[model samples]
Target: RSYPTTTDEEDPDSNLNATCPEYFRWIHEDLRPWAYTGITLDMVERAKATANFRLVVLNGTAYLEQYQKAFQTRDVFTLWGILQLLRKYPGKLPDLDLMFDCVDWPVIKSIDYGGPNATTPPPLFRYCKDNETLDIVFPDWSFWGWPEIRVKSWVPLLNDLMEGNQRMGWDEREPHAYWKGNPEVAETRQDLLKCNVSDQQDWGARVFAQDWKKESKAGYKTSNLADQCVHRFKIYVEGSAWSVSEKYILACDSVTLLVQPRYFDFFTRSLKPLQHYWPIKPNDKCRSIKHAVDWGNTHQQE
Candidate 1:
């Protein structure tokens, strides 16, 4: 969806302000505390003038005209993704230059341990309010707000499964824990795969290796979200730093066996242990996961 060129007075129900009115209001009101503090009307105006693009801010709403021209060829996906997010809430999204960065292994490989950009940026958005110079303050795509293509497709199905799981009582699900994702990105995931039930130690976790390329070839219809929620417990192990799958895992009614994460997203820190999810040790992942699964299965009433 594209932003309207007409003024707010010219068209009260502009294309950007029409759909998701409540969502827009929530963004304007709720997200005000988290908005970039450095961005002023003068800065916005100067950015618009210098870039030779029209960015209209009317009634706390920002309308970027020729937004595509400001971005480079490499940033197309990031720009499109951010625009899709803005389109979701319309005029409610704040007027700021949202920076994007990859948080996976590729980004990690580029950084030197004791180098300049190493300790500070961390290849992901920093959550602190004091860091005003850093315009990269928005939450990752993993959280609820952003509208990426993969997220847009899977979230609905996941929500449906969540609703279905709620209807089908917790006791009905299988006694074992479940987790499925690609293990190539992080050694933590590889370690998780190794924790699967074997003669050495019974982890009581049904772990599956996800082949994205193979799944894409098969049209991704084989991996049903509802089928995944059939277990009494769900394990959440991060891929690289943070995985979008965390939210999906927590959405299920089953007990969430969360492995200690290296990085925390916008909302992850807010989640309480033994309440929202059962936390497992990062050091002894195999043993911790096995213990958590066993305890949860034994205390089904809890």
Candidate 2:
């Protein structure tokens, strides 16, 4: 399969150096464990218990050693992305062997490997990691596409969100905060759902449980990411781990009520709370969400 490549003629500014995102600095720290020792085959093997697959790139060709089938098609698309990179940049990529875990949580805790008897940390790539783990974060498979859930690739979906934002300006949206996702995956989310309006209280939050089975039967019309941009504020609460819903909510042009997350993905480190999102306390979710919506409503210009 052929992939698109940029031409200098197509964009004269292609040669200009652009500032890298702040998170790029963390690459050094992420690779620190292996900087002196270097990653060995034994280190790669150590990660197999938690890794779904082992990938090797040698001489512009790719090989995979699957330990097990990843949940849904996560491993499928992840390997597809690597193959595309090989095609996109021919001989630029180095020969390397790596372990990739498709699961939500990072398993290699840094605390486990930090003592006099500590062994060199095995390098493991995964979707998200907490500050306590040494797992290297990579972009999740949802970026390319999440066909099982009907979420399109990042670029096209982002285009749809931009169009959605234009359709309903921020001032024209509903005044309450909005969030829609499965609450069954995490108790934190179940707690968040309690913030939704009820007969006894209206927390200024409109949270909805996403019944994927029901939505699948109905062709996901109600769950369309673009259509979710009707609220002035959007809420982002972590499910099992760091969620893939983050970029979608932030792109909605609504004030994002970000519930404090324990884990983070590849790019979220660059996001600043007050500038990019309004922080919501996970423990006191109802009150925090209420305050965010109210504050955004009051500070319309900001």
Candidate 3:
């Protein structure tokens, strides 16, 4: 998480020589549509329908034009994330204004803007987007911390998970694939719970329902993200549009049983199906999950 900084004493070019990561290509891809016709104020105004707020960054200072309040502290943390970016790279970001929506589903459908007589696509920033959408994707607010859930920031939480992983070798971990999250938010997640071990069937998966209210009452001991790496495989399924649990599931030092996702975040485009995770079929979720776990149980070296 440490960033390389250039001081007046050192040549700025020294740090510039390092190549940008490949995942940065997505940023270019997101903005490519507007590259030809630049973002106009009119285009910005067009996005107001779905935007929770308009963020204007001019001369290193930021201003917010709130249209509607987002759920909980989403807008607050989202703006905080932007301010952190402005602070991390001072005097580097250009003067710009953009619309931000904190909703789960992306609204700017490609079908709407792809017709021959269609108007220019309005630029919008959101948490996640599908391939059929034109919305620019950004990292979720949980990157800073999910305070309500008592989850720490990304770097420290990742360090804690790594330490937890070291305590138990992958081979020594539980043979069953594991998943624990709220199933009520999406039917897909509710369907996943059916794959769990039962008297009639054992799907090689262990799934638990996350009771945030109960967890909060218990001081979040059983719900700690760092302590959930006890299994050799972990499941990640999208809730609503996309869940913020993808990174955490991948960080567990275990094979990931990733349910096929319709929406993607800023960095998930770089993940390969078989290379990064075992893709679980949405239609045949139970059987697909069982197959992935069985494959992992047999192919331990992979």
Please report the candidate that would top TM-score against the real structure. Answer: 2
Q: Rate the local accuracy (lDDT) of all candidates.
A: 0.59, 0.88, 0.88
Tens-place lDDT per residue, model 1, 1-302, is: 45633333543445864566322342343234335443444544433322323434454344545533422232333344455555555566554542233323123222333364543222222221121222223344333333322343345766777676876778888888889999998998898888788887787888989987887777677565666678888999888666767877888788899998765554565678999898988788777887887787788777
- Candidate 2, clashing residue pairs? none
Model 2 alpha-carbon drift over 4 Å, by segment: 1-14
Local distance difference test, candidate 2: 0.88
Runs in model 3 with CA error above 4 Å?
1-17
Arranged by TM-score with the best first, the candidates are 2, 3, 1
Residue lDDT tens for model 3, 40-97: 8999999999899999988777889999999877888888888877766766678989
> What stretches of model 1 exceed 4 Å from their correct place?
1-94, 102-139, 142-155
Model 3 backbone overlap count: 0
lDDT of 1 at 273: 94
lDDT of 3: 0.88
lDDT of 1 at 63: 51
| Cα RMSD to the true fold for all candidates | 8.3, 2.4, 3.1
